[model samples]
Target: MSVVVSFKVRREVKELMDKYRDRVNWAEELRRFVEEKIRQLRAEENLAEILEELRKAGWSVPKGFSVKSVREDRDSR
Candidate 1:
């Protein structure tokens, strides 16, 4: 099943799209873009929830812990 999505665009935008419409599947491209954005938004929301949980649990990094230091430590091992 498919749904129709209709939106108004500037005349120039419409014209530009029409010019390349035959060269591209615009609707499919738009669908891909929308799907990727949706995934990104959901990931961000999940991360926010995790951060809130961590805050409630008083999670904190030790003063000596740093990404660079950790990388060096791992490299030395």
Candidate 2:
């Protein structure tokens, strides 16, 4: 279940890519790059949604909370 995707590149860019045609699988390279970009974008979108929900609920930490918590955990260990 796959479809063809195509785009045009500058003439110089195409020439450079053609030079390495035997050493590279351009289709696979483009596919992996696109897949990785989509994953990164989705993760960012999810993070933004979570932050918005926290903001709406007025969620926040008091000043020095991180330092105090870290020191307490270190002392216990």
* TM-score for each candidate, following the candidate numbering: 0.80, 0.79
- Compose the digit string of candidate 2's lDDT tens values, residues 1-77: 99999999999999999999999999999999999999999999999999999999999999999999999999998
Give the distance in Å from residue 40's predicted Cα in candidate 2 to where it truly belongs. Answer: 0.4
lDDT scores for all predictions? Answer: 0.94, 0.98
Q: Would you give me the overall lDDT of model 1?
A: 0.94
Q: How many backbone clashes does candidate 2 have?
A: 0
Cα RMSD to the true fold for all candidates: 2.5, 2.5
| Regions of candidate 1 where Cα sits further than 4 Å from its true position | 67-77
Model 1 residue 13 CA deviation (Å) reads 0.9
lDDT of 1 at 19: 100
Winning model by lDDT: 2
